[model samples]
Target: MPNCNAHDPYTQVASISIADYDYPLPESRIAQAPCAPRDAAKLLVDGPSRPIDAHFSHLNDYLPPASPLVVNDSKVIHARLAMQRSSGGRFELFLLEPIEPASYEAMFAARGPVRWHCLMGRAQRWRDDTALTLGSHPDETLRARRIPPHTGGEGIVELSWATGETFAELLDRLGQIPIPPYLGRCATADDNQWYQTVYARHEGSVAAPTAGLHLTAPLLRTLEDAGHPILHTTLHVGAGTFLPVKGDSIGAHPMHSERTVITRRLLQGLLAASAPVVAVGTTSMRTLESLYWLGAQLIDSQGPAALHLPQWTPYQTDRTPPTAESLQALLKRMDTLRVDTLEASTSLIIAPGYTFHVANALITNFHQPRSTLLLLVAALIGARWRALYDHALRGDYRFLSYGDGMILFNRNCKKA
Candidate 1:
């Protein structure tokens, strides 16, 4: 009794709901701590042909000999803060995103316009709105003012600083890095380094690009020495990545939008390179695929009569078929003029029906059940995800960010 249109198989699989993606994970398997030396973790290479088990230190062996590896260079910021109220009440603040410099608000369950909102904590005694003071520094003093709430259960707070310095500086002086809740541990001194990727460049993401966390400078040098190229893209990992799909069907769940930037030079390299393009993490894969779709749209519009003559009338068209190179040049020119370079917010949920325009192979960490990450994995390898997960679980391969990784090659890859 399911609708089975030839064009849409998703609607036909009634029993294959979001719940089907759920698997029983033991509490003990959760990696509360990361492996030392970062690259000392495990790696499980699962492909359509065979499964290879190895340590993370031997990662370079699995990559395509000389293929370029695209990496997400977004750096995690210290966003969590602690406050104490005059009433002797303590509240924990987990900074989601920046709204202002020194004085910004966060998600809290309290009603008032006062100087503080109480966050839920141990015992029922701490759940009351009380005057609180933040910052241990002598020059820093934060007074929180309650504001209107927003969607997704987030509440606003107005912050007033005692000093004239920008809010960012105050945060850097006081806030702690917000680690994942599952870690069940406070952000210690070691997290400042271990939680970050060796190639992290852009500084805005709240969460570390877990897949990139496996890459070290030595591995990168080895890749470069082997004639493989490495490109960097930015995708600020948002707190929403930790949220699970609560809907019955994966299609019914709404995906969160994340800001991403893919440079024109990187796009051109991907299009021109004869070597395969391997995405370092799912975040990088999303950025590449999103940009490729945008580029493809431009390519489709550059036909004989479809060209926007005003933008490219100065250039001559050769007899040779038009290529992505020319389009990339035009995009660069636009960028120099302060125009957007294929920039846009993407909520591109890569479920089964989505077609991949970029990325040949993916190096990623094992993901949680009923998560969007798993859907992406399923989309990449068809039914191989189940087998891969089962194999990893049985073989003692770690799971989740800070856990083991798998290098997956798309069987449906065009070149394959």
Candidate 2:
């Protein structure tokens, strides 16, 4: 692939290998169930300044009191489907992302026509050219026909549903929320709601924005009443969220592209707000950083509808120079056009040596070891991630999506 001048700075940064981000997480620490009344969960506040243990309910105390809190409102759908082969052998089908309309023989795995792969279960048993039918007919019908194969042992599965009935409607009836295998249980009635965040609105993601799951309606109301600005962006979480980096060097790892959207109004709000920007989850953080690097200005509304930022692409632009004001202006113009949102694909992976263009603080949950989430946490706080993980291990912070939360304030921003 040819390199773009816009990505030069990113290319110059020293890449951190996947091994540096690995940590020791006990199997017992992974939470199988959510804390009753989500906000009641624990929170571990760690930084170079000080490390403190607290409950998620006290999240406001760590904030600046009036800073803008940006969150990803992308909702998780029941993307997991159970299908039987011709021999009556059951296999699992997890929807990664939407490639085409639910009714028009849509594509899966990654969007676009060229790469339409999806992760399939029982790979050893299922042949390369297997087909699985989903849903009952008369009202609506859906089927998944396997196409060619791809790396990581996944293959393309073309989906088709009945006409007049939208894909969303078909999924509502035939699909199950594609929870991580680490959850160690079958989907239940509670999963339909517990797996999703209270603020979830956009319906495109296959995985839940776990960090946002800790927030409750009361907590949001409190933040709003306290004069803190809140804005939302959407990034449809894909199967890539769970793919582990296999290569020793970050460069060798294949970055998966996921769809993201940032509205002009949300951008304007971030620029105009007197307080610093705090991201609610990693998805929101990625969207803000990607947009900020794209020379997105309130004035660039008419130029393009969506922006694509691949992981290997540099996050800075010479014309833009990566500034908060410029990003805010870009978002403001989007808002003015009532283009509150812009959709694009991102393969950008945040790690150490990468400079953050947006978000001063983050509210996230602890992630699994050897996962991209762990690498992101390490990048946010430098080497302190190791020490923090050690602290959590000793202090009993539940690990993974349903576990405890953390409020990470970037030390680099403080020094700057």
Candidate 3:
């Protein structure tokens, strides 16, 4: 692709080779289960001069005083369902997003039949017209059929069930929590609670925002006591978070869009913040950074009704506005429209060359090699991310979801 703004960081970072992000992750380091007390997990504080090792319970000690923490409270739905063909062959349907009604809230409230974009486990054997049934429950019957693919070539499945209950209820009774596949095991009894964050509220995500999994109720209280403002926004994590960078360069990889909902209160907090805005997870970081660009679009008079962010929007322009100015513009628009919440989808990719506008620090877990999550870390700390990873590996810290976490500050930020 051609560089529209030669001096911009996005232009430099967008063309970076994915191979540069690769690192050796031993299968032994992948944590399959979480520690007993979530706060007992280890924390690697990526300090200014060197990385400091500490327990997660001591996270407050590492944070800059009075920092506002933004967390993703999008809950993980039981999106994985097991079904059987009449011949007794079994298959699974992994729900991605609502299809028919095109809204998560509307789809969950819907009764009887609902359509969704899904990935079939035994897709080859599932004929177009054939139907599959959930385990024989006499009172509540559930059935599924393969529908035509979406315009993007993703498979769509139609699910029909009747129990005088909402689709959400049916899922709670029959579906399993879709844990990360790297766990190399089926979703067990513990995952229903273990994989979810204590702060999780809205039901939509297929996967857990793992970094939030390390926070316990007491830890949250301690932070509040220390005068750190704890707030939340929602970003329903998608299955695409697990997808690897397919090509050599990031420019060739397609980014997935996730839905976000930010409240007027959160916007006000951000505008009034006198300290660094700390994002509790990659999802939250993405949401905060995307808000800046969304606000920029609003300043440009982009239609508020249609507010989907494209992947390359940041790179397309060199117009860097003051963060507060952009945020105030959004607040002005919200006031004129008389809305308390702003809902939009973002496909923003935070790579090495990306400039930080909102979040000044990030708290997150170790990510997979060559993954977009790792790239986001690189964007904050630059190549020192490699050194931090090396230190974590050498120090015997566990990796991935259900493992340890770290607190990283952006190099450009004053707190660092």
Candidate 4:
């Protein structure tokens, strides 16, 4: 059995050298593309005897019976747009998130000029006053003008078009799907379909929740038939998912905040669940865990008018209320606010020392070495995470976003 005593209340784990998480990843092991049928991809299951190599289709066999599987339904949008300055110099603008309206739904539906936080490639080349332009006709023309930088040096771009088409429509016509940069190739036509998950609906994320990529509609139906209810929450994946830990220690690294949405129905299912909920991806896992901390804020402190969980909030104290009590606080807030869904943002970092309030099993793809994602796995199973990766690598399972997946049972929580 794996040890579950990794949690430290003082957060000594944050000071642990990131070098401890490092591993040798040969380029050959990195998967450049997904399996033929998404469900045909390999699955590394924690079997009764030992780690079991199985097919993704056999996931139901390993899952705790009737445990709800939570998925991130945030859709990846066509966010990369290439345009040219009047001087014929080219630059790419990658849309990060909405700014003016501060709501994804409103920003996408707004016509004419809308502000967005965007990153520009070759931003130095373009004059601050000059506008980048695209499109052949006046009515359909799209233009981007620069605005004052945010405190973190993230560039703000004002996107405008003469056509009455919404920002979402303009993106569909001009922007490319922003796939993982490690793929070492440009997004092709197939990426428009292959890069997205089967259940994706809301358009906000720049990247797909990769673990959910392996699930097909038929496979999902099979899980439901086996009595596992599928629930959804949204965490719009950001470019920060690809940001590397530049510091030697985890404490020096800053976690990125992403927009999250959890519906009342999803919250109800989680509170009612008799077994540990299965998080489909790291994004879903983070969203679920962040909810507990958000609720605890309501019970312990005078809750903020809006939800915004800081990165160090979880590590600050160990006043963990019962999971039921914490979730009830959220429900009470919703009743008081008279809202069906809670919209919030979180920069929560889940490392080895962190205690998980929700989600005990994770269905996720193999992550990059020394990444925050890997740190999250270490938090669940301790030193065994290293052994688990070695098992997968030695077995020749593909790695990274377009790679094989695993269902890890948290040592501290109920196992399948």
Clashing pairs in 4: none
TM-score of each: 0.80, 0.85, 0.96, 0.95
Model 2 alpha-carbon miss at residue 185, Å: 2.6
Stretch of 10 with least lDDT, candidate 1: 309-318
Q: Write the per-residue lDDT of candidate 3 for residues 1-416, one digit (tens) a residue.
A: 55657565656666789999999999999999999899999999988889999988999999999999999999999999898988999998899988887888888888878999988886888887789999577567789988875343358888898688899888988999999999999999899999999999888999999999999999999999999999889999999999999888898777888998878999999987888899999999999989889989888875568677888888778677788877887787779879988778999999987888999999999999999999999989998999999999999999999999999998785321
| Superposed model 1: Cα runs more than 4 Å off | 1-16, 100-132, 149-152, 162-166, 296-343
112 Cα displacement, candidate 2 (Å):
19
Worst 10 residues of 4 by lDDT: 1-10
Model 1 steric clash pairs = 85-132, 101-167, 102-167
Candidate 2: tens digits of C-alpha lDDT, residues 1-416: 63445446554433456777787777899998889899989888874577899887888887886899998998888888787666678887776655444311242222322223467887667766666666555345455677654555476677665455556666777889877788888888888888999988878788899998899999999888888887988888887888887777666667688877667667678767676788998888887777765554333444455566667555343354446655755655555667555566788778766677678888888887777777777778888888878888898889888888888988776211
Cα displacement (angstroms), candidate 2, residue 394, comes to: 1.0
What are the runs in model 4 whose C-alpha is more than 4 Å off? 1-11, 149-153, 414-416
Residue 256, model 4: Cα distance from true site in angstroms: 0.9
1-416: candidate 4 lDDT, tens digit per residue: 21234555434766778899999999899988899799999999966458999999899999998999999999999999998887888889899989988899998898878998988888777777899998877677899998965443358889899888898888988899998998889999889998999999899999899999999999999999999999999999998999888899887788889999878998899988987799999999999899998999999975888888988888777688888887888889889889988888999999988778789989999999889999998887788888889999899999999999999988786321
Better of 1 and 3 by lDDT: 3
